[model samples]
Target chain A: MNNQIEIQLSAKRKEKPSFSDLKFGKTYTDHMFIMDYSREKGWYDPRIVPYQPITLDPAATIFHYGQTIFEGLKAYKNENEEVFLFRPEENFKRLNRSSVRLCIPEVDEDLALEALVKLVSIDRDWVPDVKGTSLYIRPFTISTEPNLDVTPSQKYRFMIIMSPVGAFYKEGMNPVKIAVESEYVRAVRGGTGNAKTAGNYAAAMLVQEKASAAGYSQVLWLDGKENKYIEEVGSMNVFFKINGEVVTPELSGSILEGITRKSVIELLKHWGVPVSERRISMEEVYEAHQNGQLEEAFGTGTAAVISPIGELFWNGEIISINDNKTGELSLKIYNTLTGIQIGKEDDPFGWRVKVE
Target chain B: MNNQIEIQLSAKRKEKPSFSDLKFGKTYTDHMFIMDYSREKGWYDPRIVPYQPITLDPAATIFHYGQTIFEGLKAYKNENEEVFLFRPEENFKRLNRSSVRLCIPEVDEDLALEALVKLVSIDRDWVPDVKGTSLYIRPFTISTEPNLDVTPSQKYRFMIIMSPVGAFYKEGMNPVKIAVESEYVRAVRGGTGNAKTAGNYAAAMLVQEKASAAGYSQVLWLDGKENKYIEEVGSMNVFFKINGEVVTPELSGSILEGITRKSVIELLKHWGVPVSERRISMEEVYEAHQNGQLEEAFGTGTAAVISPIGELFWNGEIISINDNKTGELSLKIYNTLTGIQIGKEDDPFGWRVKVE
Candidate 1:
């Protein structure tokens, strides 16, 4: 196969739908980019086809064993009508990391970057210009082996699907209350928790329900051994502010290394805000809260740049942070990230990867 | 459903194929049992339909998030044409336990047991009369809501699918070599490790591949916190013999409480084999190997009653057990399990539930 990508556009296109007529992930664009791989043939059949349902055997490995991994990024439309990806190379790196853990073959970095550019360039109109909206790009790989035994699939498919999504904070970006889940574990050490696999997301549903039932927005997962130290929030990486110093949980074997978490650290360091990636125990957080030293708590992810956590419930006790309001470091870092993402400020760190 | 199951059976009858043509999970019978639950409608629409493809949106939770769980059991055929399930009620109890953790609605125990019996009766021809072969049953539930956000699915479908399976061991039960996975953790504390979900299976694939690459059969998972204590072998629960006593990992949050493991324990107890479930640390196992106290090790699962572990690769060292041969206890357990399953002896505990 040649290094060049061939553009075969979809003949059938859907009537353009308004961004308002869409939900988070319920609506999709007219086209999708797909590529296949096998041992006999490396990578083949790269095309942009009309978005349609994928036909899988009832016994496909993905359905039975959950051999799947995915990535979430966005194509932002700047005022100058340019489609840009915020540090797409980071997503590419993370995608391969996830692939290695799921036993799926990794894609060529050059080829994957080219495919992302081609997909976004052809579907540029899907990039919504709403303040908090963007063209959400989902790149995923699934094991398509037609076997019943629990083993890694020999064949896989990498696909890029685009969906126009609105503000993550549908009502408003109010501080969220969370329940600290001490009983269940989403991922353990020597597990695939760091990998953005479908299993990790699926495994979190029960704990998420428990959090909601406890009248909290999400659950803060503790370490797998003792369930005492804060690990992560699954979808997002967590951070805490104590006496104006930023402290996030040190990446144990199970916590996901989020792209947003990385960017937040760099941004805070660049802005000269005190930061530390050390072990942050729940007991310490509670003690700091009681001593009026815990000033802020927020979660960072692709969907939400920064979501402030106002109240937290642990061991049948509830504690509030920042007077139940978003914090100073959070607002500053959020401004910096979105500014660099939307081409409104200088990309000192060269985090923005322009598609066109 | 009525107090008595009003089964709507499919008229289509599948011709029985030769027992030699049995595959692991490919072929299925004519009818499958199904029951559904809704917020308004609680556990309605009990029917037996011809095996068919389930039509679902591409964005369904099962396809993306992997919110799926399944239980595996088998029906064995005896010489006198009697069919029995090896402790099927245990499977039902475990299934509901998994459902509670996944937040999926649970079916009535009596109704579920009845449905299992009815389904097995309808497909009794698939059960092989061979000593080691039987018809495998897979009862699974999946979240079917077509949405992309991170929340529990409201709609779910409970289904039972049966497939004719060959023997796990063709000629005789052979010992297997295992690769000790030090890098990955399958399940963690305070997570869904206890639940039988797709994520846990998917999480073990990478390690499984690694073990297979190194000419090993399975990977031994370590505790997520320390990666030292023995947890499980992913699909099968592991057992170790030290000083002539059998010790398996305690039912910690991360280990799957396998039906075969429980049954073997019961069978051994009845036969006066000392057995205990406690936290067996890897340090103890390794030290015992050096002390010549570690005699034999094996794993138990639905597919295989007892698979002996011939060797283990841990920390760049290979420890051989039983001289790469099947142990006495392993063969005894396998014979007992297969005997009880095939109804060759008196089932004192009434573990065998009659299918036909």
Candidate 2:
């Protein structure tokens, strides 16, 4: 409640990684933000401590029950060495939403935002300035209670760790191939699918491995109950340009409410492009492609910003779009979004927050 | 792959809890068993060390992705002070099955069983000898890789921790009231429902809390796809006696293949009772009750052994079974199964494995 953070600076900072050759989430910064919560004390002991290993009891609820939630966002450094975070408030808000679903306590968004700004400022040297490089921030909460009861935990820890990441794809902005997965389902209505919890990602690993083995970058998941309607592509929200109209899956209870997906819709609407959020089935998409109405398709997420979908493998058929190249609108949206992120373009919507 | 285990006993043991006043999973033994796995070395390091907290990087996959699996069994002590594990080999085999589903590497069942037996033998003094008590054995595997990628981890830790647990229910082996969960689904077909994974349990917490708040011991889950067929009760499998026949939901993908449930069916068959495994819908169950044919209902799991269901709350109606008392068959099953566990009865099925 006091919003005062106890800061402990690292005695020595490690040598920075080569930004040009950095791998996503493989390198960490010098300091991290941590806050603890308990039923008796609520949320307390907010601190910025040296990045290090964390100790947990052997019987902690997290190890046995997987009671955890996480949020991912990035911090960009401009040519003038000015660091910016894009729409960070939304991430914290969504984190609270996820906590509600997972039965974990909510963190004070204002305090969390303050903590992030201070942490990024203290570790500003870790933010990469190279082209297509940024600091990937991961804020996660895990149950720390040492009990085996199948119930909500009474103790928890909220932490923010950061990593310097290279571009999401090795081929830069080239299109990727995604295979449609029909065997394993990610989430369903009245489930934790919409929440950014650990279990959802865990459920997708096996299927993603299979897709990768088949030479696809990711897998497109359908609705859990029927396995017909498109829910998401890998972990990102998907969009399609059909008959010159922009359409994406509705905010179904089973699909994650991605922040970037919201921004893409707003940006399209702002540009006078017709965009709609509705249930679009895989059958409908294939039929549209058969009718030559499928124009472009891409996925929106914080990791890639915009990943153009060039080829889709479904039912043993390979459907290539836009001649297996990035769509014109996809490139424009990527450039504009990345520009706005780096403070190169005007922040018409006041989406950027400085790290100072 | 040497099966020889390195051992380091605890220098000083902690005070043992009173067997009559024990709590489930609250008091642990002095030492624990551990095995480490890496892609390069496989599962190599096998050791028994002092029970202590584990250190992990903040970015460990288990914290953010819930890449973990676990198994539960019990070790009982007879009057002769000899310890027996109730079908522990089955638990390890099921653990490997869960690993396959969660994309975790499967442990050698024989090796895991050997480690568990050895660990339990060393901690035999911790086994409670009370009428309704045993040493709860938790064998779990967690991803230890410090990476943010959504793929399966290459590093893992398998551990066995012992806890002296009292009776699962504070009221002894009495019947429990169950509320039908129609809102939050535990898991769906093609999901992690059948796996003994952390994510499945994590997804059930919020609903379990609601059930507890509403004056119910647990919630009876319906199928996620249609919410019509009976799936499970809490984390256990359920059965009903209708018209002199015992019926349970079949081994559907969304229901856990409970070892206790299997033993119960076998015991029923051994007694020449008519038992069937099929899709048991709530409507059919209610109809059977209305027709005065639903004789008994119970849940089966390792924790409770056999939990009789006395009342069901669904659609604003209370369906009281067996006059809100434990049924004859329920009591007989609980007594027989628990008797066999503690070596008080004939081990006809060879379910008990000695810790020697």
Candidate 3:
């Protein structure tokens, strides 16, 4: 664990059962890690304080300009009740990348990881061991500069908040039906689409609701330019299976490079699966489906280990895949990743970093 | 003005301001008008209370997803010390347009206008009489469903806050240089380009800062498809003076249909100036400049009445308009528009709505 987060416990810490009846983001631990950064102060005043409300000026940049970036990783309890973070360093690195794009201050990668590990360790009991559950850690930094001008904040607040999450999928790994949102585009090139900033999600909300109202669980966003190339499936990165070849969209300037997407690629490669990252257009996918060449599709993200996409309705044209069920490859990947995370199997990639 | 707003002031009011030293958004007037909406209670609790901190659940949809929309207008004190709102009806109409796009509930237009007028009346001294100054009115609504789901919020909050704003443009509107961002695309077809939502502004912030850092005042965005067809100029709509004919890019799905753009078109048409809206590409504009057929270029918006384009730098190419000054036609349009706003000229188009 990063030793940087020195705790100052809240006088209001719950006495008992705080560890048992926990739901994601509903209950918080006693303390939250905070750090301040400014051009004058550099990075100073790192403290773990009582979880409380932060009184921000009404003109704070975060309120007006949305200059915020966040990272989500989890601390898991293993079979032996030992706690470990799955690739904590990766979250920090990705957060910094998001920071650079949003013009927010980047963090010292090592210190961020340490803070997350320490905070999770302090609330280790909050990490549920009842299979496929963990303690969700939110490392977010907001532009705290109180100004009306739309510039990057000179001063900022970096915070880490922990929440106890139950099963991420709730119903386990189940196949989902998504809509091809040809009428709406999520992001465009040279935009904040690649960054984990708040605006990208905001831009997608309107169409996402439309898709959901049309009776779909998620949305498959195509490239904004031609509305053809597959970009993202709602919040997750997508993969398609065609004739036993696993194909996913290459990370372009407009697509987020998801950590789960990366892990899946590496694991598939290690297992000698024919995986390729290329630009797969909508027409090709539709034509393949029509010809019965399409096997399956799924999405990958932190909240969802793997969500199978069973069907797609593209611009009023519907296409159903084989069985409308979770594919074999996705099921295997989900199990293997979950196994490594819960200490049920040896992590050959050394992905888990154990917290003391 | 919309007359649908119901006001219930709190038992407090800030003392009158001297009105001279007021900075934009620094001092909020007393008695802010607010309303809430949900599926059950379509809209309720329309009240005007003392300006105070709003108590929001930490998981408010606006905090997590940027499902917020806002409008910027101003109340001007005419010579008789009477407050007047310039085309507030347009803002109310536009606000609903933005709300629909962001999947937020719409407010009654009459109610919105009435509430604004009453609030401005309560804080009349905040309306600055100084040239190029007025009491800035920010009417905004945010979704507060307080959930992590990416669906449209079941509940929404609509509020109006007023602050005295000096001249919006720091430099008196002589002209400004803008960088042509071929690399970054602002909005694509079926995107949130036409809406005055928070996400669009957040998406534009980094690019704007980059252009400023690169020594330009603003950015000129291109279509996301080919990066060729000129869209809006950052936040405002663009117009060109070519061979004595006023020209603007046609409102493709990506271009924001600016109110000022329509006003300018109507004003130009009234004065017998030939105007045409068509697809104008960057290559064509540059070619016109090279052939000396491009006379001038300027931008139009609520805040920036008219900003002349002095220089455009696009991918190592710098194109300069003649004389690096505001064009003649631009000055006429600015003067005509402001004259109508400040009640200095004839109200030919019935644009100004008196605050009752």
Candidate 4:
């Protein structure tokens, strides 16, 4: 399909938000990318129009059946005015995998990447040149058919929206407190956990809210079956450093395959640090802490590259890691990943793709 | 809060679809009920207006986080042209339970029920008067806040839309073939399986589509943990008659509390049938079938009052139930439930609520 994307620029541009006061996903760029899919025509008519509200029938499957998938990546601007994206191809690839799990149609990854580059190029001014801010790109697909049947939709819409987000953490890379959830489970094996879909996040909200009310920043979920194996923390993949070795939960079909998690593992291996991807249970962490071997723990995701764990509360027991301060290794990983993302470090892994 | 619902009738009535060719949820009535919820005002501004499309920001929480819940019920028109709702209060009650699980705010059940009845009364003309037809009512709530955060939304919209649906089975109450799913599990014990939310349905689509492709009407899901116990079939609750006794899966935290399932149990008990709700593993089911003790199987839901399962395919083996015919008990339950719904039988259970 020789599908050339059509561009329709906005007639009047709106005032952009100040980068200093930018909040995540609260502001949008001048233009957005959209494409439609149908069982009869597949995906067609790719277009970039002004960012605006989307009108849908109240009975659209997205609202009633939650047939949606999304990917989050950012376009970074350096002091040299050059824009770069961090491993965006992987996001589109993962999006297609999510589509298969939700029974949505697979998208053309190459075409989707082309569309992303074109969209960023069209809205280049929105990319922030500040120290820690970047233009967050969100590409999502939703079932648009107005059918109430509990079946795969026959029509869909794929869209890309941009938001200039400030630093994830207001202060420097500080550690956060997270509570271990015992009553609620986010996802399980043979479920939609591996897919970057909406339901998984929805299922975790109540637990997160309760944890937040108790003065914790996030909730750490345990496995659904035994409720002993650690899965993930909030929406991020987690890692723990015990006795001079780093270990994270393996991709056990119930945890998200985060891009940041993959990059962190790759970076650790490149640096020759001992890193293992295996099942690290909460009991093991507690025992490591008791033995004074649990040195540091942190979470990895696109939002916060490395969120240090200051404290963890599990079953009425509290374990403080690294004296409730950021660990040296956590700080190093955060700086390295961010440096590579902003073009300050050498591109040894070829993870960055230029927008121009 | 003294809330009097305001009504704004549609100026131009839509051309009603022919009752003989009506489809489920395809065509909607002229009007709909809508209410808004905000952190400060709670649920307010209850009103009924012309059915129309809803406009939302592309980053609305409902589209990204799947923060939505819905209920399905029917309004029947008896021979006297009186409209009746079958336990709609129960739907609103269940909606609140689903909202709690998804972290959305709870709505007032009494006010929502009043709104439903008022909306039905205004659209009473749209209710089909055919023998097996009724107005399918869909009451749903969605997060309307334009935010990309994984937290619960501060704003929400509750709506009710009605559709004239024809008989679920076009040709008599013919039995259907169902394949037991082994690869994809729908919901887990501690997950959002019990909630009538969008994610659960979305997760079941892939397996359902595969089963349909293999000449089955639905896919029967197994327990997510063990994959040995029966969970549900498609979107409905399942029941099996074994050794001259009626049994359904007990209300585990993972299975939906289906109103139709409750009604079936009530009717069975009222008639002095030996009914039990407990864990029934697939191994036991296969053994029963082998011993010729599996007498009948069926599913219960609002869409289909009682869907008889004529054939079951599990682990490369197929067993024809009641010689691939609708069981006598299945037919009896269907007729009794439909009779009560249409006011053809005595309302001893007080299941029906008059709309006018």
Best by DockQ: 2
For model 1, the DockQ equals 0.58
The candidate with the higher lDDT, 1 or 4, is 4
**Estimated TM-score per prediction?**
0.91, 0.99, 0.93, 0.98
Q: What is the descending lDDT order?
A: 4, 2, 1, 3
Candidate 4, which segments miss by more than 4 Å at Cα?
Answer: none
Give the per-residue lDDT digits (tens) of candidate 4, residues A230-297: 99999999999999899999999999999999999999999999999998889999999999999999
lDDT for each candidate structure: 0.81, 0.93, 0.80, 0.93
Show model 1 residue runs off by greater than 4 Å: A1-22, A78-81, A169-172, A316-318, A353-356, B1-18, B21-23, B26-44, B287-295, B315-324
Model 2 CA deviation exceeding 4 Å by range: A169-171, B169-172
Q: Please give the distance, in angstroms, between residue B287's alpha carbon in candidate 4 and its true position after superposition.
A: 1.8
RMSD of each: 3.1, 1.0, 3.1, 1.3
> Model 3, stretches more than 4 Å misplaced?
A1-6, A14-31, A169-172, A315-317, B1-24, B168-172
DockQ for all candidate structures vs. native? 0.58, 0.89, 0.48, 0.85
TM-score of chain B of 3: 0.94
Task: Please compute the TM-score of chain B alone for each predicted structure, in the order given.
Answer: 0.96, 0.98, 0.94, 0.99
Compose the digit string of candidate 3's lDDT tens values, residues B1-356. Answer: 22345556667667755555556566777667788888897888777777776655445556667787888887877677767788888999999998888888888988888778888887776688877778778888877765555677899888888777777655667688889988887788788888877667667787899899888989999988899989988788999898899889898777777878989999989999999999998898899888998888999987767888888887788888767887888888888888888888898999887765
lDDT of 2 by residue, B1-356 (tens): 66688999999989998998998888889989999999998998799999999999999999999999999999999888878999998898899989988899989899899989999989889999877789999999999999998889999999999999986766666889999999889999989899998888989999999889999999999998998999999999999999999999998888899999999999999999999999999999899989999999999999999999999999999898998888999989998998899988999999999887
True-vs-predicted CA distance for residue A30, candidate 3, Å = 4.5
Backbone clashes in model 2, listed as residue pairs: none
How much is A285 displaced in model 2, in angstroms?
Answer: 0.1
lDDT of 1 by residue, B1-356 (tens): 55455566667677876776577876777777777666677677777777766666556667668777778899989889899998888888988988887777787877778888988897787788866778888888877776778777767778888888887888787888888888777887656677787788888877787778778888888888788889887589999989989999999877888888888888778889899999988889889999999999999998888889999889999888979899998888888778888888777888888876
